[model samples]
Target: MDAPISWAEARTAMHEAGRQGARPAVAVPLSETDGTTLAAPLTSRTDVPAFPASAVDGWAVRGPQPWIPEGRVLAGERPPALTRPGTCMEIATGAMVPEGTEAIVRLECAHHEHGRITGVARARRDWREAGEEVSAGEELLPAGSPVTPAVIGLAASSGHDTLHVHRPPSAAVLVFGDELKTAGLPGLGRIRDSLGPSVPSWLRRLGALPVEGPAHPVADTLEDHLAALTSALKTADIVCTTGGTMHGPADHLHPALRELGAEYLVDTVAVRPGSPMLAARLPGGKFVCGLPGNPQAALTALMTLTEPLIAGLTRRPLPSLRTVPVAEETIGRGDFTHLAAARLDTHGRAHTLGHAASSMLRGVAAGDGFVVVSPGGVVDAGMHVPFLPLPLYAGEAPVAVRQEGVPAVPLPDQAHAHSTAPR
Candidate 1:
């Protein structure tokens, strides 16, 4: 067999040729559309604020202090014109300004005695101007921008109750292993199904829909694997299979994919702990990613293949890689890239984690990001290296799991983890 390609080469090839996010845009309600990518440009249908409104609880004066008080204009009310510079109007927060008002006299500075306002500090408008936030026909955000809470607020302010956004991609995960148990601790040669519960969470963070039930754990038989693949393809845009990229008798990904008309885009990559991974494009513009059974190896494959795949499928931009200085020197492989779990310090420096074996996630769940060491690279202290980050909501602490069938693990808070790749 030909040697596996480099990690960078695999990423470039997949991105350059993967199906462009040509999925039709959907007009989703702003209430339920957080984290979606905007498919169409977000233009303001109406000017934000619509009309000039008071920014503070103050008096709307024509020009200066000691002006004649016109009347009270609370929020949601429009005041008539203050035709002369010597006149003033009592204006509340968010109230519309009179046409001829020159400035606002704040309640603190205005001396209100017998309904006559005075002591206007200066001649300045303290109200928001019409189209101050965004003007009508102005583009608030371009297509391909991720819809965040602030984005939704901006859309609402621009008179959009619904937004034209790229729909979230749906994915299916197939967990392949005979020795994997559905629950409980690993003992007596049977390990708990780690990927079944974890992969879906990872997928959701990448802007895919949440996996409803548990991940499908398939039997070792090839027929069973074929059935699972066929079923997942019918509903999912991408199917991720774990533990079958190798040539073991139980491994069935390569053979099943061939039978199912999948052409390999990435057979494997020259990366430590995840070199057995594979990726292919299936019929109907769908995709399949094969990950190793080891917990950390599966994570590596998720970042290496699944991350960019989801970005492309959902029409979001690929995450840009960042370089950071390491706290200590670490040895790296001579022939391939090595992704090691590491924790970031207060100053944004990286400290290597020791528990990054192929089978364990102790270091992964405890750390902030991975340090990508290049081929023949000697990582010295203060040397810069590429880093891939996980969504860090509250920074990964263990949670208690009481159910016998449930896996006890620490997961990031997906809602608060809105930013991608910590700087």
Candidate 2:
């Protein structure tokens, strides 16, 4: 028997394949740029504020207390430059402060009587100076950065009406099994299909566009598998096939790829429950991911291969697996990386979610992410172990890095909102 590829090796192969086939960048309106990645560095077209602006709702004064009121400047209107010292202008937040303005006095900090404003403030130049936030021709965001909501706001403030971003990758899901049903309860040696709905959510979470349509069902026969594979590759940048990854008599993924002259990037990965996961590069440069029939195994396959693939296709960085300390002992396959569903409690510790068998989704539904236990090593409490948030489950970064990793909410049509029959 051949040894399965290391998890890192499998991911690298998929990422390289995806990079080779990454769709070219296109200019999209700012509204549609979210969830994509910048194909090129973002430069400000003009100064961020374009002029000195009030940082708060107050009065812009020069030379401090008891200044004569000149006029009022509401947001969106410009005030003429100050003629001399001891002059003041009422200003609202975001309103442009007149040139030669020294400081902004908060409404509560200023005492006005007989058209004169008096204030006791120590700070000077309290308003934002021109080019303070960003100067024209300055780089705002680097290439490969995710186009998050905050990024959108920055681009707009930097005078960008649209963004150059990677075109969203397209996908197709092929579910291979003769005994799979799409709806209603399963019985009589048949199970309901689960990949039809869940995998699309994962795809969207990684920045892929919606699947072309419902998944194509494949029977155990080689002919059905060949036909489905051929058609799915034509329009999809990547094709996800659930089931038929092993060498069982009915497994036809290998034979189908062979017939199509496809090259196997990953025959298997050394991960528990999903060791049979596979990836291949099609003759035309598209990708095919073979996921085990078991739901958890398929999800593991997704995390190992599909996530990096989408990241590369979107021209984004494939970051290191984030890890957190585990609070409880968990164990799994000693020969391969052990993956278990887990929750992070308020104290910042990972706790296992029980019932995490390859065939069960209950633990996944109850968990926030996957806990990683290294091969052959017993994970002890307080051990720093790898963890991956489920599709659309990762929340916002700390306040300090919020702009870089803003929170993302799952779409209403995403998997969390939709249910697929179990298979």
Q: Model 1 TM-score?
A: 0.87
Candidates' C-alpha lDDT = 0.77, 0.78
Per-residue CA lDDT of candidate 1, range 79-115, in tens? Answer: 7888887788888889998889878878898787776
lDDT of 2 by residue, 1-423 (tens): 267977767767777778878878999999998778899999999987798887888888888568998899998996887778899988999999888777788888999999799986546656777899899999988898878799999999899999999977788888888889988899999888888778877777666775665444688999988888888887888899999988899899888989999888888888887889988888778889899999999998998899888877877666455556787777757568777888888976789987888999888888877876666657666766656666643222212122244333221112211122111
> Which parts of model 2 are misplaced by more than 4 Å?
63-66, 108-126, 393-423
- Which candidate number maximizes lDDT? 2
Error of 2 at 68 (Å): 3.2
Q: What is the TM-score of each candidate against the true structure?
A: 0.87, 0.86
